[model samples]
Target: MSFDLTKAETPKADDAETETAPEESAARRGGLVDFLSGPAGRNLGLVLALVLLIIVGILTGGERFASTDNALTILRLGSVIGVVSVGMTFVIAGEGIDLSVGAIVALCSVWATTIATQTMAADYHWSVMVFVALAVGAGCGLVNGVLIAYGRIAPFIATLAMLAAARGLAEIIAKRRTQIIRERGFVDFFGGSVAGVPVLVIMFAAVAAAGWVLLNRTTFGRRTLAIGGNPEAARLAGIRVQRHTMYLYILLGLACGIAAVMLMARTTTGTSTHGTLYELDAIAAVVIGGTLLSGGRATLVGTVLGVLIFTTLTNVFTLNNLDTSTQAVAKGAIIVAAVLLQQRVARTGST
Candidate 1:
């Protein structure tokens, strides 16, 4: 009987360990998933996706797909939208949206190249035109911030109104015509490159660097995350949610100004039609970059990769003679897929 009891107890002990093993394995699996859905993981996934796309491009188009020229073209095309996407990242990170960004770009560009600003620049310095563009962008952002933060208007309505107003104003200023930039220095300086890298690319890199530092390294960035994650809790914790919200919009506006300058340099013209549907492109890049649409978390690296991915996809499509309509469809599908993935990740993390 004693021997039988010992054997039975030993079996029970072994069974307990076996039961615990599954629990341990499940915990490890959960941890792995959390890591994957985290910022670093998301960026890694985007990088892999980008590499896969590159491989597909190479397979489909041979050396032409991997050419240095094509690479530069992707960077160049991505730069303007990429810059705008940076600002959009801030807005979306704060649980907000700015539909007016593209319109703001067109407005800033038109304003900077207008006879008034251009004449002032020639009489003074070319930098004045740049200043005006940035100012107009900041000013527009300030308005959006005020309306949303103080006026208590909804972000969608506020920004949507701005989208129309800004575009309308641009048309009014330009008389529905394209304002060709006559400042050769402005064009040459911005369009030129340093060490064989386009200045536009440099500008994009610099902006992304600054954005990363601002969002990840500063008190302002911390507060932004707090507010987006939970505004009421953030307020109780001593954050100025309203003011911070306004500042977010202003940051976005400043980004649009930078984008406007880049667009003007590249195309040598500022038209009301410039930046049409740009908001969609910028938002897509941000969403595809892995930023949560519902707000709280922000990922600058993801945003950059998202920009490159979309830009590369567009380039590949063009090289293959695919239509713009096809590109649009692909983008829509991507947005839906990204949002779904985000929701799934959130659920898994919660469970």
Candidate 2:
């Protein structure tokens, strides 16, 4: 009974095994998580971009840039671009593009203005024209979807064709002239702000919130992501690839319509060339925000930040009296830089 060596040895062995088991398991788990998340880490670029923008804005505007008014201005500008990019994010994530967005926006603006000024004003139509304009956008998207999904056409070519067609339609209605509306209520609602905050900005937030919910929390979003990730894989998985692709275009069209309404409300006119080159801007915003151009993987918040980066740059240049051409050049350079940065991270893992 005095000091049994076997009992003492067994206790020591049990204690050693218990201590080592948890340490080894945690190490394995951490390694797996790190791999899944990737060494580059999502949104790292976005964070860096935001910091740099703030620094530049602070330097460029001096006290003005730091002011709340300046901040609101940045937000208002960013919001308009943000709304369009939000929809573009879905399309890009699904490996598609909408060249028709700019034209669609112009179309919506003219349509809404036509309704609000001509018939709705006299007949007391509470945004009936808005509904009609929305339907037009959805229809345009449906046509695009059919061609892309069913006809098996390339997305860029299909959307580029749609772009021309929609722009032509917008031209027909605008007649190459900007039609101004004298509706005070309409102008105030869109151009003016609620409690000093632009309605356009709020509208962007609403659209973004809806997009977030759709992409992150809904079944339609799941299908969109799956289709983007791999249409063939999605089909093999029993998901409706064709139908989803068609609907995704429709959704993008709907977003274009919404953007148009906001534009008309702000400007109180429908112009044929209102959204010239806006499709590129929207695409840039989506890409800068961290969405892979190849399809699949997107971040709603990243798109918002991307819009901010562009808008902030534009504002700084404008305040400094930079010409339009110069701003365009600068923006293009920035876009190239952002894309290159993303590509580097994508291929090399991390810096």
* Candidate with the greatest TM-score versus the true structure: 1
lDDT of 1 at 314: 95
Q: Model 1 misses residue 47 by how many Å?
A: 0.7
Alpha-carbon runs more than 4 Å astray in model 2: 1-41, 115-117, 349-351
lDDT, model 1, position 297: 92
What is the lDDT of every predicted structure here?
Answer: 0.93, 0.80
Candidate 2 CA-lDDT value: 0.80
lDDT (Cα, tens digit) per residue for candidate 2, span 168-231: 8888877778888766666666778888888889899999999999998998888888889898
Show how many residue pairs clash in every candidate, following the order shown: 0, 0
**Over 4 Å off, model 1:** 1-13
Per residue, candidate 1 scores C-alpha lDDT tens digits across 294-333 of 7899899999999999999998898899999999999999
Backbone clash pairs for candidate 1 read: none
